[model samples]
Target: MEAAVSCLAEHGWAGSTVAVVAERAGVSRGAAQHHFPTREDLFTAAVEYVAEERSTALRDLFHAGPAARPAVVEALVDLYTGTLFRAALQLWVAASNEEQLRPRVTELEARVGRETHRIAVELLGADESEPGVRETVQGLLDMARGLGLANVLTDDTARRARVVAQWSRIIDTTLA
Candidate 1:
């Protein structure tokens, strides 16, 4: 699964075959096929693996007391800026063109998005009962995703820091 995520993220959909992933995994192609049965299954499971990692990251942030607004903002942004987001982006693009893969990818993305939003809300101590809080959290996630998209082609680090810092302030004021 790690190999699949890495392969898909680095090499993209056409380049990442089950055989390639199996070789990277140090296993036989037969073994991978036995487990995954199809390319969709393999990639779907790979994305699901990444989603679990994201949930774990958010949980760790909560436990480690990154509940401080800046820390939470940075951590949430970090989630999209990393390899997992790249892998998922590749899947999303493939799913866009592939009729067979669209529904599964769409459903998985919805689940991951919802779970991430839930965790982000908790870590940020967001009061969803109040007006606009839910939208605010969703906007933060959407903004993070845009940052991740901006990161794909170039070194968005310096600029991303500025954006993150500004967004942190926005969240602080808006949520305060």
Candidate 2:
């Protein structure tokens, strides 16, 4: 899946053939086929893998309180900086190029959004009626995604840290 991610990142959907993924994985085409018979299957698996990893990371981030929380939050922000976000962006681009991927990509994105919103609500201790709370959380997610894109394209560490700080402020304000 990592090989497929790298292939997708480098060549996009059209250029990332099973053979190319196999080559990148340093496995035989037959081996790759044994695991993922089709491009759609490979893409689906990759998306699932990334989502699972994010979920695990988020759970770990929230495992501790206060002292470790800030660092965990920063690590969470760093996770989105390039690696996982770039993989997801590649999938989004792939969906544009391949109709077969559109539905799954959209579904995964919605799931992530919903899950993140739930997390934000819990972290903020805010109820549904709270004004601006939902919007702030969603805005933070959007900003995080945008910063991820910028980080990938420009490798700008300062801007990435600024994004994290802005998000941290939202959390702080909401919890206060």
* The best candidate in terms of lDDT: 1
112-141 in candidate 1: lDDT tens per residue? Answer: 988999888888999999999999999999
* lDDT score for candidate 2 against the true structure: 0.71
Cα lDDT, model 2, residue 127: 62
User: What TM-score quantifies how close candidate 1 is to the native fold?
Assistant: 0.97
Worst 10 contiguous positions by lDDT, candidate 1:
57-66
Off by over 4 Å in 1: none
lDDT of 2 by residue, 17-53 (tens): 8889888888999988998898888866876687677
The TM-scores, one per candidate, come to 0.97, 0.81
RMSD of each: 1.0, 2.6
* Candidate 1 displacement at residue 2 in angstroms: 0.8
Candidate 1 global CA lDDT score: 0.92
Model 2 ranges with Cα > 4 A deviation: 66-73, 123-129
Model 1 residue 1 CA deviation in Å: 0.9
